[model samples]
Target chain A: MARRRGERVTRWLVGGPPGAFLLLFFLLPSLIMIVASFRYPGEFGGLAPLFPAGPGEEGGLTTENYRVFFSDWIYFQIFLKSFGVAAFTTLVCLLMAYPIALLIARSPHQRRDLMVLLVVLPFASNFLVRVYAWMIILGPFDLLFTRSAVILGLVYVHLPFMVLPLYTNLEKHDPVLLDAAQDLGATGWSRFWRVTFPLSLPGIFSGSALVFIPVLGVFAIPEILGGIHDWLVGNMIKEAFLGVRDWPFGSMLSLMLTVCVLAVAGAAAWLAARGLQRA
Target chain B: MRRAALAIEALAIGLLFWSFFSDARYALAGAALAALGAAAALGAFGQRRELPHFWLWFASILVYAFLYLPLAIVVIFSFNDSKLAAEWVGFTTSWYAKLLADVDMLAAARNSVLIALTASAVATVLGTMAGIAMHRYKPRLLPFMVLTPVAMPEILLGVSLLIFFLNTARPALALFGIEFDLGVLTVIIAHITFCIGFVAIIVRARLAGMDESIFEAARDLGATPWETFRRVTLPLIMPGVIAGALMAFTLSIDDFVITFFTSGVGTKTLPLEIYTMIKVAVTPEVNAVSTLLMLLTLGMIVVAGRVAPDVLRGK
Candidate 1:
């Protein structure tokens, strides 16, 4: 009984502060945002009050914001474009990162550590500054305000995300299997195809997810690199809240984005689970 | 095969070296180097039985160039005589001097450092306590709840926090007869919110690997629970705590989106200032500031790497 009481006290002391803070700050705000999404935008910009006086109230509660988003062809196109950019970035990053990861994985232990350190070092730098560097590199040409520029920036910023995970996965892989396959008359290409690539699928999935999700929601990269001509969902959300003051629309979009993100997350989890089960 | 591999290596390295001095028009030479290096590495690896893959070494070198190019450009331009980032007339440190003279830039940087320091300190305490409790108590579903912030998009978190401050926090504070507003305080709170997860995960990883027998040995020595914790547990996990604190500090300093949304009027952070600066024009002064920020960040990560290499390894 004493031990039980002690454990209870410990739990409260340990979990109470963080739990309460997140509940108040993180979870509660999200619930309020979701609720606000169902409401209408306030007149003259900004979010409307929750539980407004009546239907006549400016930006009162309504589902119209979501309806407008779903109905608008422009919004759909923007969403599609955002998805395309993210997918393209992930694909490019995967292709580029694989060789780096393989090279690092094959290095001596000390060199491997140094290589991984170098990869992570760039990521530790200011994200805005890195994108700014791209702006300088690509800006002189006519490439600054284009979708290609946006894709290039996305790939540049996110390549490390893909490489790190792939490297980790590759580093843990048993090299003896490759040798075994080689002894069994498997050629180099066939060895990778038959043995190495299959084992690295989990890393590929994780890297893709990591790259795709951030690229999907990235605002500054697109805004700064792609300029005003190319806007992703991140920019759309930013404009809705800060620029347009259409909180209702922003909320609706946020809700949709949350759903899309959750769907991607759920699918990844499902795939990982299936992979685990098979193993 | 050996001769071909060596030739590819030499060509790739030669192009990479030549690209630096050939001016901005030949910047594509860097890209060419990258491509040739990749192909050479592939070719060498495809025939590994005959000769070693020496060209793979050049491929790794080019990959480093790709990763470091932006930072290198920023640092290089900071010393350029011309105000334009692309042009390189002669080397000058005037931009660094200009950055030092800019009061607004200094003020923004001061604000960033202050907020990051306070946030990291608070997060370390909260996260360390939570880490200890979680290991000792093993609360159900709490770990998952804590990790939610790390998984969510920054924009979503920023937006939600903005709304929360406006709609929930302010109104609630008003009920208590206090005025509440968004500024440094709000940004700090948001930093702590996100930072707690990182600290907790890192500390927890350290705790998981700790030998439980040490704690028992303390207990057997008739040490009080607090004394055991102080002498044994605290010392054991000090590296993790420091690592987590460094990460939180670095993240908070580099953060822009969350800070942008949370910062009210007159609360500009460094990233916000840099963004505004770039949006107007890409001055050499901005390059100097960016280069400094990059150096500070890399320095911190290097220190953190030394303290807890495994923390960086994502173990």
Candidate 2:
């Protein structure tokens, strides 16, 4: 009985603080954001008040924020454009990541770590510095504030994300299978196309997801690199919260974005699992 | 195959020098650097035994070059003597001198250091507890709460936390919020919130590889739980704890977006200051500061890797 009490105390001592911190800092904020989305904007800005100040005061509750978001075509177009950019970026990251990931995986066993580190080294710098690197390079040739520049910045910052997952998946692949395919008179191209590519589907899916989701909500790359017309959902969300001080609308946009992200993550998890099972 | 590779190499060498002469200097320089890298890659791959195809070698080198050449350009341009120096007139360290002299930038750097040190210290403690708790106690909800923040888009956290701080610190923000350093504390909280997960992940990964029997042995040998942890688990996980601290510090210092959302008027971190500078003008001083920031983070990573290599691997 004493030992049981001790165990209980130990559990609380070890786990209680972080659990409480996350609840206050992470969980509560998320819940508040959800609730905030359903509320009305304040007179000056932000949300008016969720609870009544006095007895007769009406609560700040409404579906108008959602209604405004859904009824708007411009917002939908921007969301679509962001998704389109994310898809394109993911595709490009996959293509760029594959060659390096494959090479790293196929490298002489002792050299693999060094090769992987090389791939990750540049990314260790500040994120904005990496973005700024492109500004200097892209400033010339009239490409600084353009769609291609935004795409390029996204691809550069995110390439390592795609590469790491793809490399891990590729590294796990058995070389014996490749030798078996070759022993049966499979040409190099055919061997890769038939066996290697199919086996890497899980990696590709994951890499794509890793590249896709963040690009969807990134405001910085667009804010810094792209022209005025390239505002994504993130840029809009920022405008609502800080610029316009419309906390309700910002919460609404954030909630929608969170839902979209969770859905994509779920789909990726399902697809990756299926791919793993088949492989 | 050799002929084709050589043909590619000659073309690249030609372009590398040609781009230096071209009016659209930087863009062509990037292409030329990619080409030169591809050429060197061919020579290196040619000597390897039983490697991938020459085309693979060619393509992979170009990709690596793409990854690196822009930063190289930034570093190279920082030394150029002119403000809008399209061509290198002479090498100078004036930009670095200018960066040192900038008062606002210096203040931002100081604030960044203060925040990173405090946030990382707190995060390391919380994250270490969470790591040990999950490893030993196996709490289900703790893991999810710890990791979800790390996994979600940073902007989600930023905007949500903006609302959160505004609500929690409403009295302070109630007025104009001019004099209050509310954004600093809030940004610190925000940093710790996101950073805890990474530290936990690294610590947990470190713990996963240890021998479970050791903890059992310490327990059986009449060691109290606290004594066992201090004498055994703590020492073993020291590298991870240190690595986690360094990683958290680096992350806290470099963070911009979440900071951008949460920071008040007076709270200017280095990234925020650099951002405002970038918006104001594209100067070589920005390049100089960026080069320095890269060095700082890189040095930290090297130290982290020395203590705990797996932390560098995102484990």
Clashing pairs in 1: none
Interface RMSD of 1: 1.7
**Candidate closest to the true structure, highest lDDT:** 2
Clashing pairs in 2: none
- Candidate 1 to native Cα RMSD, angstroms: 2.7
| Cα error of candidate 2 at position A189, Å | 2.0
Candidate 1, position B201, lDDT? 87
Q: Looking at model 1 chain A, report the run of 10 residues with the lowest lDDT sum.
A: A270-279
lDDT of 1 by residue, B129-153 (tens): 7777678778765676577778767
lDDT of 1 by residue, A1-279 (tens): 986786577578667987777777778888989987887666776676766677666645688887888788999998899888888899889878888898888888878777787888889888889888888777655688788888888888888889988999889888899999989999877988888888888888888888887777889888887767578899999998898888878878888888888877777767756754553
How well does candidate 2 reproduce the true complex, by DockQ? 0.70
Candidate 2 per-residue lDDT, tens place, A157-274, comes to 9999999999989999999999999999998889999999989999998888888999989998999999986799999998998888988889999998998899888999999999
